[model samples]
Target: MTGSVPVHLEVDRGAVLDGDLVLPPEPRGVVAFAHGSGSSRHSPRNRAVARVLQEAGLGTLLFDLLTEDEERTDAVTAELRFDVPFLAGRLVAAVDRLGARPDTAGAPLGLFGASTGAAAALTAAAERPDAVRAVVSRGGRPDLAGQALGRVRPPVLLIVGGLDTEVLRLNEQAADALSAPCTLRVVPGAGHLFEEPGTLAEAATSARDFFLSTVPGPIGT
Candidate 1:
């Protein structure tokens, strides 16, 4: 695998988000991460999954959804983190930015989202039907996407912790609303955070396999 580098993405003209971009040699596809509420690109769990994908020859982009100032405000008011539409717009912009980059332009695009970020990923996939090839949500709140769930065209994988009952039910509801192919898998003994022994590794492996199968490319090319 090639070295990963820090990147500053301008999702809007003046709005920048911090990210880390990792490209493997002859990567087959790229997966962009949408972290949950109160999380950033630095999330250790997402980072761990990103490492697995990179080793498998899939490029990964882990970016913050909110600007530094916005995060601070949301910390106090707890409002903007749940704004699905707003977060979706940012995700779409990030996808566009990835497509525009020479190193990643030819690779198929996928999204991996966690928590409320899963809703944003679903909404963005619905918005850009042709751009996103696949989506995977880890312990996510996909039901928060509302009507947008029906519009998504890419195959989706919803990974829920077996112990996270409420979220599992929500994922099932969201799956029923989807028009595209969708699957829900539960990691036994895992909680919302997948903190149980070996559960997170299992989740990451599932995500890697799903993207590899759904994205049209020669793996490790």
Candidate 2:
């Protein structure tokens, strides 16, 4: 079952972070996951999204932005949600780590993030415009990016729950700030996490399509 699709990897890329890496057989591209507030690589919701993306012929790396000790401290302070610069640095490192991997070298790359992770992803996309091809946000708080929003060049899709009014507004505001080719998709009845079942699937499908459409070639050497 070589081409049957590889499920996961125990890759140690000196990526500066640690977590799960899932790959398909000859993946069409890669999607790196940036977990939301208080979430990590083990997040069930992110895992679900990764599952769908994998089935769509993409590889996924779900890594924790903070170390265990930092996570414990962040849990009490709740300030990690505002640490977009730190998170963005790690994300870019992870993308570089993947780019250096033999198996992932030829694949186009994408970023899938939730909540604060979305802001971090936007920062990374802005910093590494040549590497990351596309971006996706789910109930994300890209507003945290402040003035960095306009720097991202990749096509991005922001998926918000129509019922999550506050988040919907935040996403709308963020969408307006971005200078990239982007869209805001409000999935009706699917509050924040798209916990309403098919809504998440729809988000996943939309994300897959967006990434596939934007990432069809190689980055400059």
Candidate 3:
């Protein structure tokens, strides 16, 4: 477990988002997390996956997609949580920030997105084809990416729970829409949240393997 540092990113003028950046010595690549609806950088599930990736010698950036005030409003309206374009914009900014940092610069980038965040991740990958190396989604709503799906150039892995029937179908559809290399893996008996024993571990393992094979180079060097 390499030590992680708290960092702030200026997504826009007067808008700063908080994140935790962890870089294992000689990390193979850096993966930025886009949490699901109503979730943030502090999400235990994302943090757990991030920890696994870090241990595998990958750098990780887990950041909040919304500010405190925005969350307050979203709690009531439930609108911002589904705003794909807005969320994707923030993710793009985060990727750019990582590129500019000495610690993460020049490293291949991957994205791990859950639920609605998956849609944003796809959109960001489509928008920044040269920067993102790969993408992974867990129980994600990638269908929300719409036409942008065809433009995404990086390989993508979509992990869904077999019990999450609707989302699995949606992921299948999204995979078909993508022109880039895409794969869909369904964890048997797992639900939408992968709360069943060992389900999350399976998903995390899949993510780690996908990133390892897709992202180029050894860690730190």
Q: Of the candidates shown, which would achieve the greatest lDDT relative to the real structure?
A: 3
Candidate 1 local lDDT, 34-149, one digit each (tens): 99999999999999999988888889999999999999999999898999999999999999999888888868999999999999999999999988999999999999999999
Q: What is the lDDT of every predicted structure here?
A: 0.93, 0.83, 0.94
Every model's TM-score = 0.97, 0.89, 0.97
1 or 3, which is superior by TM-score?
A: 3
**Ranked by TM-score, top first:** 3, 1, 2
Greater lDDT among 2 and 3 belongs to: 3
What C-alpha lDDT, on a 0 to 100 scale, does residue 213 get in candidate 1? 93
Q: By how many angstroms RMSD does model 3 differ from the true structure?
A: 1.2
For candidate 3, write residues 23-87 as lDDT tens digits. Answer: 87787999999999999999999998998888888899999999999999999999999999999
- Give the better candidate number (1 or 2) by TM-score: 1
Off by over 4 Å in 3: 218-221
Clashes of each: 0, 0, 4
Q: After aligning candidate 1 to the native by TM-score, how far in Å is the CA of 98 from where it should be?
A: 0.5
Task: List the lowest-lDDT window of 10 residues for candidate 3.
Answer: 212-221
Candidate rank order under lDDT: 3, 1, 2
**Candidate 2 lDDT, 74-131, residue by residue in tens:** 9999876578987888788888878888877868999999999999999999999998
